[model samples]
Target: MPAQQKKIIFCIAGVLSFACALGTAAAIGTQLWVKGTILCKTGALLVNATGQELEKFIGKIQYGLLYGERVRQCGLGGRPFQFSFFPDLLKIIPASIHVSVILFCTVLIIFALVGAGFFMFNAFGSPYETLHGPVGLYLWNFIACSCGCLIMILFSSEVKIHHLSEKIANFKEGSFIFKTHSEQFANSFWIILVCSLVQFLNTLLIRFAGFEFPFSKSKDSGTVTGAADLMY
Candidate 1:
């Protein structure tokens, strides 16, 4: 292959990577938005559940993340406490799992790219050498990152409503129980969107190494790629 062709192939890989990144971001953003709505709605339902004066305060709690903060403000030994979506480090498990899968995929991609690149370089020993193998690898890595983003988003949506309700009850009782909730669409939406964007950007950087979009297929030919293979 010509020297120009090798560069072109790499560029194509970059574009594919970028596309994957975008998909990942979209998923995360949606998850965050859903979470916000869920929490706010839940709080409202509880506030009206008992017909107590505290019902009016549901909005207040939703607005400021006040319920959880109040628990942290609990004065005693001045112990610093924090609220998290999941218990201790366990909360991160789902996201962590997703991340882990992405990382593993990234490693495999790197290996494949290097092997392919090296093979092409040695085989053609010219501009064609550049076309080699790394392009496909980069393409796959982008896909993996995107997949991770999706997993995290789906997990977020599955958040247990009952758990949040109990937390609200604690706050209403004036007990300093640290609560983590999903409600208040504004905040939740933005957070999830931001998370998604970050993941997307990260994936883009890793996959594309910064390039324009609409990648053209490789000249190598013969091989089908699908979303299912990229993600799972």
Candidate 2:
């Protein structure tokens, strides 16, 4: 590719990395990661509710890593409640797993910002003979992508295996036992997946910009003398 074309590629990748960072930050603040309905098993059994009557015993729940909103419908009108993970949910939920998810999210955002900075630097400035060059681009994007993957896996396990929604629904309730009726990952969870895909795409763009993968080139040719690298 021409020097001008390479700059354009790097610019595009930089913008994408920055956008992913912003999206992840926004996602962490919102309560749209997991959305589901919880059924009040005890209430339904007591009222002998069947079919359409069961609607009164079903409630809605949604949450992010830190905080969320839950509405209880135990044969009565929905009662809304808000919760936070730090100190409020430490006793009932799996504290270590939840904390790990938050830690990975923070890592993903930081690495994404670093990747964006490096991409812009490689495009507009003189290239250094160190990790700040092409190698750093690959390193940062890979780390961000890995963090994204881990966030999805860990959170999925916490929600499905640990019965997160049901636990939140029955948190302070002494009369009703709630069970997960329906659940799905909401927009914010999918946003992290998209960010992971974007990071992978950035790697391909770096390759398309004429930079070889760090170790794929033969050791004898590691000190390469190609037209691709001269402009940088």
Q: Candidate 2 regions off by >4 Å?
A: 222-232
Winning candidate number (lDDT): 2
123-174, model 2: which lDDT tens digit per residue?
8988765557888899999999999999999999999899888888889888
Clashing pairs in 2: none
- Could you tell me the TM-score of candidate 2? 0.94
Q: What's the TM-score of each model vs. the native?
A: 0.33, 0.94
Clashing pairs in 1: 3-127, 39-182, 39-183, 40-183, 40-184, 116-133, 117-133
Global Cα lDDT for candidate 1:
0.37
Worst 10 residues of 2 by lDDT: 223-232
lDDT of 2 at 140: 97
Instruction: Please provide, for model 1 over 178-213, each residue's C-alpha lDDT reduced to its tens digit, 9 standing for 90 to 100.
Output: 344334444443433443354345335433433223
Q: Local distance difference test, per candidate?
A: 0.37, 0.91
**C-alpha root-mean-square deviation, candidate 2:** 2.5
Give the top-scoring candidate (TM-score).
2
